[model samples]
Target: MEPVSEPSPDLAALADSVREIEHHVGEAGWDGPVRVFALVRTQEMLRTEPGLAARLDPSVLVSAREQPWHLTSVEQEELPVAPDLETLLAGLSWPSTVDGMAVSVERVVLPPAAEEAMPQDTDAALEYLLAHPERQDVRLVVGALRDGPSWCAVRSRANDTAEQVGQGPDLVPGLVAAVRSTLD
Candidate 1:
């Protein structure tokens, strides 16, 4: 088992930023395409792209003024194609202009008991899982910073309530690590 990550001064900011991205994706409903967004410091972004300020949320601008670090999300307009989401993420390397990134993707999750009964064939496995009574459709919004901090938020479609959403650093380690690598 992996150890829980130590919280940094920036942890709360990153977590809130991640949650914001997650909420943005949820606004579009489910079964949407995997979305990726670059998280950049609001101050730096404004400094580099001043014209974008008018398009940004006024509240984000207000918050940026009060905090030393405020991050804003910028959705990727065109993503490079890959056979799978993990492979696509593993291949990414972000520029310094980007302080971090967040990804929203839906996945099928099954209980531990269902693992042994899972079908071996790719097609059959998917069918079996989809047909499984315990199957859950979940959306995971994961984010990682260049400074080695990460956050994750998960909402199962079965009960996607504000109180039901799960948040943690290690909730999705593999994915957090993959995104973290890009920042590194």
Candidate 2:
């Protein structure tokens, strides 16, 4: 792993930020989990420079609830006018750059149906999310499901594209939280 450049001079200040995030979750007691965000990049980038991901761990990290990184062939109609599942999967595989590095990260697709159940913006967020993928680096795409948990679907951009890998219970939440934090 490449070494981190250097710990910030005010490491204590950074610690405070973490505590603050924890406080928000604690005070509000947001029963739902938080998501971490990341840019889809090449495996080489991840392999050669582990420190990059570690440095971003705090600001972009998230904590998850009871769920797994699931990928099954969901029907097109089931998704909103949000576009085809294949299109999204293909777009994610398409190469993109991050920090001047050639990386093609997978896009996380949350259905419109899933978002409607949440206690947040319930309007047509899916159409906008699909139409403008570049406006935001990474987003927690929410979809509404008629008969699923309000927190139905969630995903994150993966560094590698070939295989569908998922984080362990704890790391997934941190990663989701990080990504969500960055998007917000």
Candidate 3:
């Protein structure tokens, strides 16, 4: 994962917006990894989803029209514990090429066998799960666009990639979408 940079004024404002969205989605209480995707200028998205061009900000569309990578920077980092989510997000900045952002969150669900052995204490449960990997069941990856396009994928613990399970507006809505919207 790339090291996150200090957030510029614009980035800070964007983070604040995302925090509100996350609060609405209850992600503030979720224990999981958050992946940030920087949407830069690229033709791939236009090729795959031509209609997206119409919804994008005109300035972004024009700037990215000739760029090689539409999605330039993708960084996956753990949520910081201190300074709060808004503060943390506000401190990070994206390259000038970036026009939008999205966040992907993942949560691992334990299987019955693992749940049966779960400890009553939260910390103990985490330790128990770490000690016994077999108890893990599905890992859910949720992708939410700032503009409201949401998608989710699920995979067994043994699998390397997740399979798309569902996608659409408000399917797995949250702070990720709010962050993405800031780019717009």
Best by lDDT: 1
Estimate the TM-score for candidate 3: 0.39
- Candidate 3, residue 91: how far the Cα is off, in Å: 7.1
- Model 2's number of clashes is 30
| Best of the two (2, 3) by lDDT | 3
Worst 10 residues of 2 by lDDT: 64-73
Weakest lDDT window of 10 consecutive positions for candidate 3: 160-169
How many clashes in each candidate? 0, 30, 9
- Ordered list by TM-score, greatest first: 1, 3, 2
Off by over 4 Å in 1: 1-7
- Give Cα-based local distance difference scores for all models: 0.88, 0.28, 0.48
Model 2 Cα lDDT, one tens digit per residue, 72-145: 11112222231543343333221222211011122434456644443444354556555643432222222211
Q: TM-score for all predictions?
A: 0.93, 0.19, 0.39
Q: What are the per-residue Cα lDDT tens digits for candidate 3 across 17-40?
A: 333333333333344445555543
Per-residue accuracy of model 1 over 31-116 as CA lDDT, tens digit each: 99999999888888888889998997799889887765688888997999999998888888898888889999999999999978
